[model samples]
Target: MSSARTVHLLRHGATVRPGLLLGHVAVAVTPQGIADCIRVAAGATFTQVVSSDLSRAAECAAALGAPVRHDARWRELDFGAWDGRDPTTLPSDALAAFWRDPDQAPPPDGERWSALIARVTAALADLPDATLVVTHGGALRAALASACGFDARQVWAFDLPCAAMVTLRIWPDSAQIVGLRT
Candidate 1:
């Protein structure tokens, strides 16, 4: 018999603003976001619940009444000087440069998408086959990109919504996206 694991990739609950490019910043979850988590976890069971160390993610895990294992590597990409900067504020050329190849054209001092992917991969390696990961949209995109064998640039197109859940079945050398937006 073949052994398989189910990984639940949950984007953290909603925040104060949707456009705030938050990276490593401590932000609180909106009340609705908390309720959304509860709604999602109503009768779900999992081997473990892990989350980014950020307060938003931790709080969501807490509301689920599970012992969350906080992992720094699961944190969102560090936006550095661009933290909290609205995307619309970026210069057109600069934005185009980043949109073209975010893995290389990083913000003034922000982390590259490749680094973020590596961190998330390492953090995920230790998880059991069946685990629940509460993280950010960027982290989820990274996982999707890795599973789909796509380049880092492809992750930019996966705009998952807040509090969304993405399911993946990972194997030794391959991974599959089973379901999304649960």
Candidate 2:
């Protein structure tokens, strides 16, 4: 067995609702968005492709030219009542607090920061070497936390634009970013 494993977590491209919290809200990805993702992964080979069951992520996984394993565990954090709502429209203080400490100020009735970390940690336990996970930005950040032990706020500092890809080399107790493509 290899001493380390590599996982590439690719965030799905821009969706229909560009600025809304998109958890469990199925949104269509523009054709150019898909092309952007494909271009990012162009010529990058992986042993396996897994994707969030959401169509936005699944479609990009399919475009990567591999049979995909759809796993809901990779789904984005449920925004609860805030799902599909623009942050600009919400109470600014509440939105700011959620960004500062999501666990403390989670979206009303939404999934907690702990919940997201838990599910993503479990998913990391079941992966093959050189795997590609086509997922959402929230899920991508969760993967960084799950594999590297970065806290919620620290993970948020990562700039995971749509179609951004983070490649990590994961060991038993730690992970290193091997590459990144935005």
Candidate 3:
């Protein structure tokens, strides 16, 4: 492993609705989400705060009381046609197929998981020594998965709770998972 750079990856606060993909949609944080994120990051000493342009992520970053850099690259996976659809309503085979090999699957006209991985990799590569990134759950998982060479199955296993903070160590050759939260 190379010299590690500390990264505090914060998942955005929860939105008003649940069980919806909400990909590329701009949804604000629920009241409870704002409170929870403020509580979690209140004591953190961060160098800088970066967030997705979406309102939910931006609101969470705002609670940190630091200037935030909003970037579209950190947005969640685009679900495209499935953005507003209920997962339960999709064909059973559809989910199974995607889960089996997410890299090859694109959600209708949405972005592929591989593309997400590549974009996140580039973002991390360009990050400074230490930073606090507030983004979507899927975005966090993509970073972790790429750093560790985790496959699609293992990537989905990463459970990022709303307003949770995960510490990641990024290196030139590899990355390490430092910590996680509820």
Clashes of each: 0, 0, 0
Candidate 1, 52-115: lDDT as tens digits: 9998888998888878899888898888887888988877787678768877788778999889
TM-score of each: 0.92, 0.96, 0.93
Which residue segments of model 3 deviate by more than 4 Å? Answer: none
Between candidates 1 and 2, which one is better according to lDDT?
2
Please give the ranking of all candidate structures by TM-score, highest first, separated by commas. 2, 3, 1
Residue 157 of model 3 has an lDDT of 82
Which lDDT tens digits does candidate 3 get at residues 1-182?
45778888888888887778777887778889988888777655579998888888998888888899988888898888888677888777876776687668667788889898888888877777678888887888888887788877787787778888888777788777877765
Question: What TM-score should be assigned to candidate 3?
Answer: 0.93
The residue ranges of model 1 lying beyond 4 angstroms of the native Cα positions read none
Which predicted model would earn the best lDDT?
A: 2
